[model samples]
Target: MAQKDPVLALDNQICFALYALNRAVTARYRPLLAELELTYPQYLVMLVLWEQGAGAESARVSDVGARLRLDSGTLTPLLKRLEERGLLLRQRQADDERVVRLLPTEAGWQLQEKARQVPARLMCGLGVEPQRLMALQQELRSLLAVLEGSAPSD
Candidate 1:
């Protein structure tokens, strides 16, 4: 009988480590964002949407889902909740009815100004230099890409 490799055990998985770390990191953002009535996931969606601009904050549901590492099943209800809160609008694209676009409302963009302080607050709490943090981010991103099988090939 072949013995299992210790390194291949679930306890040694990089994904599990990241999962724990991700939860811990997100915990830091919770109370800080309560003032804006935003949850970590909602704030992350808003961050991505803000980059897309006011009128067309979300190019496609798939795009946002991919960026956030979320599935449509999850995004669908989240988008609906956001729409209900009047922070964003979701509708099918004219060219492709199957594709939905997410557009932030005037109220949504205003939320970005309040969120601007989150990064600074997080940095202070971590007590790390910006360069160190950037390096860590790059490493973590690479780890995520590898786990998702999205890393670019040479």
Candidate 2:
């Protein structure tokens, strides 16, 4: 009988590892995010908007989409839901009706304060060291950069 091929093993697949890790991390965030009335994607969107700071003109729909690596189709529904919840306003630029700008509302800014505990809470629940997680995050970012063709290959 032929021996099993190591390359075909599920345990040896990087894609499966990443996929599993993504699901695990997102699941861990579920309850914490629920407290903020946000799903994982919504929490990511809010993080981007909050990082942009409080302003009349915070970010364009394109800017958010680019930062999140999401297409308009997927991002639009999330933005719409957030807008409907009074967390943000989507307004067309006066100069160009096609250009949509996102402005976080006061309620959205207030939510930021409550969300401040989410990261620490999630890390505590995972029982992982913060420094180790930071290192893993950097490595993932490097891998993503290469996959996106934004980084030089060895």
Candidate 3:
């Protein structure tokens, strides 16, 4: 009998692990986000907008795109839907019409209070220790930085 290549094993593939993890995490978020009437992508967009704070001040679409690693093709429709839902407003910059900015509406600000429990709720539901999750998150961030070519050289 010939030995099979261990490298070809699905369980040994980092890409498969990551893909499965992403799907599992998103699935867990589904019902929780449904309460807010948000899809996973929509929730991510809202998180960025919320971080920018509520006011006349806004975040540039490009800035949000960069933060989320999302291209306009995907982000544009999400933004449009959020805008239509009255959760956010998309406006062209006065100084530069070419630039589109985003700001959360009053309702969106209110939603933040409701969403404040989501993280804790999710963590509790997953039964994962916060410290362990934090460590995992840091490791993932490091890995992502390396993959993105932004990691510092030793």
Number of the top candidate by lDDT? Answer: 2
Which 10-residue window of candidate 1 scores lowest in summed lDDT? 52-61
Ranked by lDDT, top first? 2, 3, 1
Candidate 3 Cα errors over 4 Å, as ranges: 1-4, 150-154
TM per candidate: 0.81, 0.92, 0.91
Tell me, what's the RMSD of every candidate?
A: 3.6, 2.5, 2.8
lDDT of 1 at 81: 87
lDDT per residue as tens, model 2, 75-101: 999999999999999999999999998
Q: Model 2: residues >4 Å from true position, as ranges?
A: 1-4, 150-154
Per-residue alpha-carbon lDDT of candidate 1 for residues 5-83, written as tens digits (9 for 90 to 100)? 8888889997898799889888888888898888888888888898887644466888888889899998898889888
- Report residue 10 deviation for candidate 1 (angstroms): 9.0
Which model is ahead, 1 or 3, in terms of lDDT?
A: 3
lDDT of 2: 0.92
